[model samples]
Target chain A: MSAPLIELVDIEKHFGPVIALNGVSVSVKEGECHCLLGDNGAGKSTFIKTMSGVHKPTRGTIRVQGAEVTFNSPRDAMEAGIATVYQDLAMIPLMSVTRNFWMGREPEKRFGPFKMFDFHTANKVTLSEMAKMGIHLRSPDQAVGTLSGGERQTVAIARAVYFGAKVLILDEPTSALGVRQTSNVLATIDKVRKKGIGVVFITHNVRHAMAVGDRFTVLNRGKTLGTAARGEIKAEELQDMMAGGQELAALEGSLGGTI
Target chain B: MAEANQAAAPIKDERVREMSPLRKALIRPELGAICGTIVVFLFFLAIARDSGMFAPEGIINWGTVAAQFAIIAVGACLLMIAGEFDLSVGSMIGFSGIVIALMTVQWGFPAWFGILVAFALALAIGALNGFLVIRTGLPSFIVTLAFLYILRGLTIFISITTTRKTIIGGVREASEGDPIAWLFGGKVFNGLFVWLADLGIVDTFVAGPKAGQPVVEGIPMLMIWALALIVFGHLLLTRTKFGNWIFASGGDAQAARYVGVPVNRVKISMFMFSAFCATVFATCQVMEFGSAAADRGLLKEFEAIISVVIGGALLTGGYGSVIGAALGALIFGVVQQGLFFAGVESSLFRVFLGVILLLAVILNTYIRRMITGER
Candidate 1:
């Protein structure tokens, strides 16, 4: 097969003497949805931060487009077309929609030594990109804090795609969302995938991962359990693995019911 | 594809709610400031009808006072938007003024060179303030509060050792014959004021030092600086990439860092900018008044923040405008002069201040709720 868009081989991260991520290998191909599933304290955050270049791996190699790459900062990773939409979506709620859409990477036109942000281009692109995700905002001037959780996630996703991100990492985008909002975010992810971008979906919900994920890499503690292609693993099986099956059964034997 | 496409179907839904232009205008936070200004003006006019509060002299009178707080408020507005505070701003004005005085007035250097030295010092101290907050992770309120006293004490000591007096006088003479001094210190559009006075539209407000001469020149340089800054500050806060960084860093520092905004640098620059404005105010004070007192600019920090808050900025951060803050300063000026013109107790303006601040905040909340469409 063609080389995956990005690959992490046996990545390990350490904080002091404690190991956070131990030899976890994962990869995502172009247009593929690779869901990284783990429960609380499963080191999912560490893995993504490493991938997004916020933290350096103590061991192993990260490859972008089949070439070995070492990222010293998040900007380096972003320049390589990797964008992370953090749980907060990296958005300013009180700012206008267009401003938040182009916060860090704003478009500008120069007038001599004086440079001015190109509000026209920013506003137009923000509206059109948001429309592609089925969100028709009334005005790009509205504050983002007024948007619903679902719409805000869509804005983040649209922003990532608009900025030429080939690898999009969504870290728990739907964690704080309601049922409808989760569905909305899943839909936005699917639209992003069709745009030929690779996605790293991080969540603990088995049903969510099954619904949108093409490949699943289950993590427990700091280690990866295994990888499963679509339909290779059942939803209940994934849930059991996440719940630590053997330990949960022993606790169930003692309590005899849900605690 | 099927599920995601389901959400994309009918992408152009009429469900995208649109607000009318009038409703949009009504929801602006500055709307409160605008209305308050008009109400205060009408109230003052009713009480001080014969007083010069509305005429050219009254305007120039209150305007210069408003300029002092307004200039500082602009700095406070930007700093507040970036999620930081500088209680040392008032002290900065005094300390920098003393630095200017000791350099030029006491030591006999050109005013321009002394002003330049003061600028360098103010920016350096501002950088130190930003560094201490960023490196040590202390709240800016505490950091700057400490500098407030430190600078005040430093100004006093510098004055005592250099000139053997707490007030450094004769700055106007020290600035004389320097071309650059005109940029920051003196009045402009003198012919306009003279013409208006000749037409009897404006009174010959003050006697010039010479006989039969009206010293009441055109608008004070302080007023001109305040207006110019209002324009420049608004554009810098609204129309530049740097402005976006300021909003993002203040809005969510972690998120801004993740997005490569260099949040620390954005905040640090804002500290320096605040110092720059304070330095400007101090320079004007020194040039116009021809002296610097150690006790100059006392309680000006609270006044500036109050102006910003009255302008509808949250003390916590991430939302505000310079125009709003400027208008807030104007409100302060009108109430101050209105009470003075009416011959009422000067302290009664404090009562007016409390009422105005409360009303502005309440109105701001109401407008925000309406804009957000909350029930």
Candidate 2:
């Protein structure tokens, strides 16, 4: 219906003669959940890194909103409204909820030689934002480490959204979560999509992909096996593709049932 | 239906047991410090009573001494909270004091001008220390240690080269009653120096020549300075964004950077603040003594660090309180001075201090684990 928000054309990455991403192409539209699925050594990490500006694709062009761009640093990506919530969450758990929410960007009031942080404003903003995400925190002064895993992920996602992230890249947001926690994270993703932000959900879970993903791209052996729309592919077909069906079939033939 | 509901609820109840109040309190790391402070206070009170040392005058004297250490310890706490150490604070004090004395005695500068120049010099040295540490990526401990020697050597070299007689030789000598001398060296009433004495609060204890009369007139201006610093330091560490950044930077520098915090700048500024506080203390010492020597504040850095650690600051940084550090300094000063009043050998104070330091480290480690929920 609209031009892709981010398009990776012929992307290639190599690490000292070992190709990590070889001629991979993908496009993510605005307000859509694009799932990148692959087994180990399938270049999923490399592709995400390239998209997040941690690495420059050896030979490819990245276009955002139909404009070609090249990123040399993660900061560059951030400047372009691309924010990544890493697996570690980049949060200080011992810090207060409000402080963690406004870690790098804190509000301040100045009085001549004396300047003070505006904790009042920080608390109000963090609480209201968390409320918008359907999280009712007991106290803004509570340490972040005391929060559940799902709640922490929500905090990170909320921080990115509040800071005007147009494209949110989540790296294994549900990997360490429980079943209910994973569902909660998926709900947050759905909420992000409703707000018209492009989301790149990177995961190895097929059920999770089927839950909120609109498009799926399977990567294998540092290359793309196929890309399909939600309605065009079945969950079992995607799983078989991820496992390299032809290779598995050949191995099964060689092993044949004994007796 | 009733049996099935009870069976399901029992399983859920067993999975999420509520924590007891005692369990919660025991798990808090700061609770240990609170208990330790109470125990230490009771011990001092007991010793004071046993030695007939509970008089108001005795309390005032001990408090005055404690105030001095408390003030510098506040600055040291800030430095430690920011994940840096300033071993040169002691030397910076000596350097600032000497600078002020030389300016007044040798350069014919007014007392006010001397104080300002000394402070500026101290701030510069502090900035330099920060710059060197940040630029070279060296540990602050080593950088400050080198600075300690450099500043100490400079103070000695300057003091040797400038003589009092040589300074006044080339200028028209003013009388002893000149306003500058009066301002710098004047006494309040008949016995106490004006700046070094507290009049309003201490006046109540002053007795008019009766048996067991209070001997001391008032608290020192140095003590007042220490109190003010403690308040300001508390505000800086707890209520400000800079304070939060300091915590974040010390907790995890890489994480702080990823979030776009200027970690290096926060650290360098902390070093500068430590030096600035040292200079302030040095100026007050010089004014109180009416003279400055190359060794005026020797080994004070160790006392400040010890005070901070004892007050509940973690060496690894991330968490600390300026007020806690001031209290820690108070504990040190009281024990040292109280030992004298109790007829204990002065050298024994060192042994007591060492034991206190060891206990503080053990307590800090335990509390840290508790706070982090680590086994």
Candidate 3:
């Protein structure tokens, strides 16, 4: 209630002739799991990009830690304690897990014009950080590609939190995961939320959103339907809102006609 | 800061064999190249049948030529790991040799000065190649292909204009008394060869009346440079943050950028490093050959790329080792020289090379997929 960790007021995003997001507003509070629920092509990606400084809002204000701030790049957002773990995770499949965890920010030790990567620190940090996320890697030297989908997602999440993320944005982290893997990712989210970091879990699955989400924001066609707390909103109503209120009826009618 | 609350139950039912130490070593990208080296060496040894090809002399014979290809191949491997290509390397060899020849032979500049000038010019060209590729977002293949022609033509035009002949000679004589040329060209230690000669290790000096004089000479300096480059390349690729950046940039440039890697800078440096190596080869070659021709170093770029590919680097980018490239060069040299030792036709060498490349690539791809658990 006392100024959320990150607040977006009437956020709008556009790409030339396309309006991907319009007057959408959402805020994530400290130590809360706020799910951004939207279907495919519902501008979830564009919205997160805006939040993570990948894109500037066409019209709206973004407040972080109670201050209006503008982000020029992803680095800017990261510096301002916002980290995004995209679905792809942005990890090198061939590289070791430690390498991927510290991709852009590798530790280095220098001696007389010769600088070397500090594998000792990297491996130590990677193993411990991943363990803290409820996912213990066998070895830091193991390739990230070898890890399961849920584990990879957890690695990304852990890396974000390790690198200082007051607000974490996960873009469809469980979309491609299997049932067990999905639950594993949910467990990771729960662990992260307990650490007092604000989480923006982007997903389209109603059950997944309802599982750990403390607050839900439903978006469709570049607009937000509404935001509701877990106790306030009914599961049936949230499902209808995600389907665009009447979009599902229209789809059902079309299928009925074909039948 | 919280401890892992690992689930009590095992999740995966699939049978994944516990990886062993030996299995880990076998999956290394360089494994194929190492095996290929041994196979090729043994094949040559069997065919040579009591020839010196089994001895250090044979190693020297094949190694000298391998060194030439290895120098350039190391650069190709690095650039490939960084997810790019520079087809202009072969032409860069010609260009650098010509520039150095002109400056030292025609302009009478000190050989060291000429070498420095050529180095700077090569780095500049490399930087330009990188700039164009990065800024325009064009495939390096197309960009470097254009440079290949541009540099080749420039070399020819310059060669014809400066000297009446396309070939420039007397570089060795021109470089006489210049310490830099001597450092690059002159051999340091004669004791090992002298000892070998005394022990009847190598053939008695084959030519001239003085040839019977137990004529052990200093080692070829280019071989030293080649060996040095191997150690340097291996360390840089494995021990440095720059190496990690190269792999990251090559693996997925977009993803690397998303995580805040300086992908553009990494790529551009790789291009420059590739060209710089070509120039280094030229410097050593001109010092060794005593001459430079506009037509020098034709098709060397393909040879370098082939070596890198044989070393188990993916053409698509990312995931490679320079030590693998070194061994790949070794495989090439052994097979090539072994043919000569066995009295086989040289043209068949191309067929053998083609087969080896195909086999090596398939093996590397299969191994990588197995390791990554990708289909």
Candidate 4:
């Protein structure tokens, strides 16, 4: 319905003799959920890493809002409004929630040569932001390690959102979560989409992808196998394609007699 | 149906329910340190009473030692809290004292001017240490260790060249009626310098000792200096944004950098603070002893670090308090002097100190676990 916020064209990456990504391309429209589905060794990791400025593509162009650009570091990506939430969350567990929220960007009260952290303002703002994400944290002073995995993910997402992320790239947000927790994360994705921010949801679970994804791109052996709209494909068909379709079916048939 | 019935059943385990408030309080993070402090204090009191160590003179002597250690330890704590170390503090003190002595006694410079020059030199040295550590990205331990030797060697070379003597001898008193000398060494002259004297406020608050004896007044100027530093350090650590960045950098430097904190700047400033503290302590020592030696503050780095660890600071950085470190230095001072009054052998005091160090490590680890709620 609207122009894409980010579009990768003919992206290719190579490491020595190994080809990590081969002509992988995807487009994320504004306010849309674009799911990248791939199994192990399918080049999803490489594509995301390239997008987040962890690696440079050997060939292809990355256009942000219709303008081609090159990123030298994660800071460059952040400056371009592309925020990535890595699986590890990039949070120090021992620190208080408020400290983690405003770790590098703390509000200061200056007095001559002395500068003090404005804890009162930081704590109030952090709590309010978390509340906006439907997270009712008991205290902003609680150590992040004391929170659950789901809650920690929420905090990271909320932090990214609060810091003015235009495009949020989630690396397997629900991969480690339980059933109910996975549902919670899906709800979070919906909330992000509603905010008119493009979301690139990276996951291998076909059913989970089908749940929140409006458009899907499937990768097989470092290349895109297929791209389909939600209404055009069923979950079973997506699963079949993900499992290599005819080749897997033939193998299953060949092994059916032996089993 | 059987699986559903099993899942529906409520577990009645007492341990899985809830812990009592008393149990929770017992597991508080600060409890271990608080208990250790009290136990150590009582142990010293008991031993001191048995050895006639509770005398007023003994108290005064220990107070002086504690003040010395506490002042430097406060600065060391700040550095460690920011996740760095300064091994050159001992040498910095030696160098600062040497500078003051050479300026005042040899060059015929006024005492006030000598102190000012010495402080400026110290600041330069501090800035150098900070710059090197931040730029190189090497561990502070190696950098400061190298600086310690370099500073010590420089002090020796300067002392030998200036006085044609290896020791440089003691400080010479200023002539009476010399305004500069009075500013540097005088008691009370209604001047800004006197008002800024280390223990001026404490002396006013606490009445002077009995008429004849030199009144061991309220607090030593050195003690007041240490206390003021403690208060300043506390404000820096808790009340400031830079303080938060320091903790974050120490706790997880990568995360701190990811969040846009200037990690290098914070670390460099921390090193400078550590060196500045050493310089201040050196000035106080020169004034108190009325002399300077090439080895004035030898091994003080170890004492400061030990005091910081005992005060509940983690060597890994990110969690500590200046007040805690000052208390730790006080503990060390009390133990050293109290052992003498308790009739303990001087050599055996080392063994007692070793025990205290081990206990402190254990207590620190225990407190960390409590804070993290680890079983």
Which digits, one per residue and each the tens of the lDDT, describe model 1 over residues A1-259?
Answer: 8889999999999999999999999999999899999999999999999999999999999999999999999999999999998887557787888999998899999978899999988887787778778787777888888788878888988988988999999998888999998998999999899888999999998888988999999998899999999989987678768777887767867988542
* Candidate 4 lDDT, B246-339, residue by residue in tens: 8887887877776678888888888878888897788778776777888889999999999888877879888777777877788788888877
Residue A154 of model 3, lDDT score: 89
Evaluate model 3 with DockQ and give the value.
Answer: 0.52
State the lDDT of candidate 2 residue by residue for A165-215, as single tens digits.
999998888989999988999999999999999999988888899899999
- In model 3, which residue pairs have backbone atoms overlapping below 3 Å? none
The residue-by-residue lDDT of candidate 1 on B1-375, one tens digit each, is 453343334355466656677776677868778878888988987999797777777778888888988999999899999999999999999998999989998888899999999999999999999999999999999999999999999999989988889998998887888977777787888898778777766665354555333446766788888999888889998999999988887877887888788889988988998999999999999888888988788888899998988887778777887898999999998888789989999999999999999999888777766554434
The CA root-mean-square deviation of candidate 1, after full C-alpha superposition on the true structure, stands at 3.2
The DockQ-based CAPRI class assigned to model 3 is: medium
Candidate 1 clashes: the total is 1
Task: Look at candidate 3 and tell me the lDDT of residue A81.
Answer: 93
User: Across residues A1-259, which tens digit of lDDT does each residue of candidate 3 receive?
Assistant: 6889999999999899899999999999999999999888988999999999989999999999899999999999999999999898556777788888998888998857899989987887787787677665656787777888888888889899998899999999999999999999999999889999999999998889899999999999999988999989977678778776676767767788311
The numbered model that scores best in DockQ is 3
TM-score of each: 0.95, 0.79, 0.94, 0.81
Ranking by TM-score: 1, 3, 4, 2
Off by over 4 Å in 4: A10-24, A37-50, A53-60, A68-73, A109-115, A176-180, A204-208, A218-226, A231-259, B1-31, B49-60, B111-136, B170-214, B373-375
Q: What is the TM-score of chain B in candidate 1?
A: 0.93
Candidate 1: DockQ? 0.47
